[model samples]
Target: MTRSARRTRRTRRMLSVAGLGTAALLTLSACGSSDSDSDSGNDSGSASSSASADQKLTGKVTVFAAASLKESFTTLGKEFEKAHPGTEVTFNFGGSDSLAAGITGGAPADVFAAASPKTMKTVTDAGDASGDPVTFVRNQLEIATLPGNPDKVASLKDLTTNSDLKVVLCDKTVPCGGAAQKALDAGKLKLTPVSYEQDVKSALTKVELKEADAAVVYKTDVKAAGDKVEGVDFPESADAINDYPIALLKDAPNTAAAKAFIDLVRSDDGQKVLTAAGFRKP
Candidate 1:
């Protein structure tokens, strides 16, 4: 019953306590390692998801664009199709108002490029647009005369007041027509047109076919017409430059392709095509 017996028992108790402490520490370390592995797995999944989100886009993208954009947008559409193989770009080019109506009426379209913000709003207000429309270009009014400008049309007033000349104008609901009206108002002049067309292309056609002497239209249209019609810039047109806006529709069948097309329209290459078509930067 002695010092040796007490010391051996005390030493045994200390060893047992240290063994339990070491076991507890190992258990906590195992749990921490498990949690770390779980966290690492979650991060990997997230990274994979992010990578998948950027997968290659392939589909048909239908675009409802203003009639004036037919030439330039057609060029862009071809470029888009080329850039994204296996993708097709289809366009519905008409009056901005008509195009807006189509989009709001449940016509399945991926993109909308209006000649003016007002037309774009018609789609946005109806919750048809996926996001705010961005203005990519601006267009000013000009007089589209016959090839060689035989009438010697000098200004907007010449088209407005020269009763001897049969002139065509776009409908008031059309962007080009509205801008022409604004320009006319700015000049404080008024004259009835021989005919009001549904779109800029139609109005320009009247001049191109010699159906009318001159037509008020976008400079881009005149430029697109090439030798088919001569363009005459007027000072009053500066006051009525229209801002062209583009947006992806909310119910777009091809959101990815639609967004990519919008990005292209805003890109430098797209701007170059537009500027070359005689459209000004927005």
Candidate 2:
């Protein structure tokens, strides 16, 4: 072969080698791009998983509520526990005045449900509430008498006029007591009770146990007593309906769970439970 022909053959071999090297580089670049895309997708999925894990609720929520809320709050607490697998709902039910004192005194509660706005103010004034309290329900006073209404107590005045009837009233410091006094004032009547109890439930219990012929208490408490007592509605009670308020405590130990519980209490489902227990809507 001539020298020029040999050079031409060499040039062709060089061109072929360059072409192969370019193809290999392109292949590796394509593979690297695909791997980067796969890694990005995995990162996105991992972030979503982390976000979901962060939102899972777990822990205990302590609630300080009025005695009148026992039945309905207990039902709602159970529902809250069911909705959050790892959560627990605990309650301290008692007179609104006492519960307010407990919360304002740093009782380590996550929530406060009061029988009256006046009671709730004690906590709010002390800066113990996270936000402004919301009125969730209202309740009217009723005269609870022994089973079958042995005293024939038909109105608030009946308890006042029948000096021998043996009546019980809640202490004026509590919501029920304040409401009863309001009703009596509205009707311009006066009554001297055989005893002044600390809470509505205590007043109702007096009638249930036959310790008293009648007692001025909340409609809900009367309904809760079932066949243990009889309830008599009075026109004056309509003028003195107590507004119930609830709030999240400022230093709630379990904020997430506390918020969730409040949401449930204000929900339609919760309203049904309260209304069923004889509490009026707010």
Model 2: worst 10 consecutive residues (lDDT sum): 45-54
lDDT for each residue of candidate 1 in 1-282, tens digit (9 for 90 to 100): 799999999999999999999999999999999988887857685676466447687989999999999999999999998988889999999999999999899999999999999999999999999878999999999899999999899988887667799999999999999999999999999969999999999999888888999999998998998899988999999999999999989999999889889988998999999999999998
Residue 141 of model 2: what lDDT?
87
TM-score for each prediction?
Answer: 0.81, 0.81
* Pairs that clash in candidate 2: none
lDDT, candidates in the order shown: 0.92, 0.91
Candidate 1 global lDDT: 0.92
Clashing pairs in 1: none
Candidate 2: regions farther than 4 A off: 1-54
